[model samples]
Target: MKTGTVVGRLWASKRLPELPAGALIEVQLDHPRDVIVCYDPMGCGEGERVLITIGAPAAWWFLPGQQRVVVDALIIGSLDEGSPPTMPK
Candidate 1:
């Protein structure tokens, strides 16, 4: 899992059928150009620190009988900024 802060939301007029119902958020990481669009199941908002799961693990997180989704990045949880001395970047 990766840690990052939610920066913005992405609105897509068109998307693939394999994509599931979720919000698309922009995450700001360590690198200057490391902002990435992620599928949010936890309903995270801007300025919030989050935990993201990437690759096949994110795509296969659904329950049994659910369709296999194609999520490259997924927001798995909201992070507690107070507990961590170092927040993302």
Candidate 2:
């Protein structure tokens, strides 16, 4: 899991048939220019700070029997309290 900011949303009228309902959010990773697009199960909107969990052994949990429906980041929840957690930059 990691902390990231919701930069934008990807609107796809047509997607994979097996892929479940969710939103694709653009997030800036822990590294510079490391921004990436991730499939989030949570209904997180733009500009919202969120915690993301990478798809792993849990990949089948969401996209079963298929490795193509990769969701490297999932929004766990929204941060409504203090500022976003920090790291050693």
Q: Pick the candidate with the highest lDDT.
A: 1
Best by TM-score: 1
Tens-digit per-residue lDDT, 1-89, candidate 2 = 67777888888778776455677789876544477777776777887887766756436556445656545566776777675657676
Q: How accurate locally, in lDDT, is each candidate? A: 0.79, 0.69
Q: Compared with the true structure, what per-residue lDDT tens digits does model 1 show for residues 12-77?
A: 769877787669999986434388889998888888988888798877776454566777898888
Q: How far is candidate 2 from the true structure (C-alpha RMSD, Å)?
A: 3.1
Show pairs that collide, candidate 2: none
Q: How many clashing residue pairs, candidate 2?
A: 0
Q: Alpha-carbon error at 47 in model 1, in Å?
A: 0.2
Q: What TM-score would every model get versus the actual structure?
A: 0.82, 0.70
Candidate 1: lDDT over CA atoms?
A: 0.79
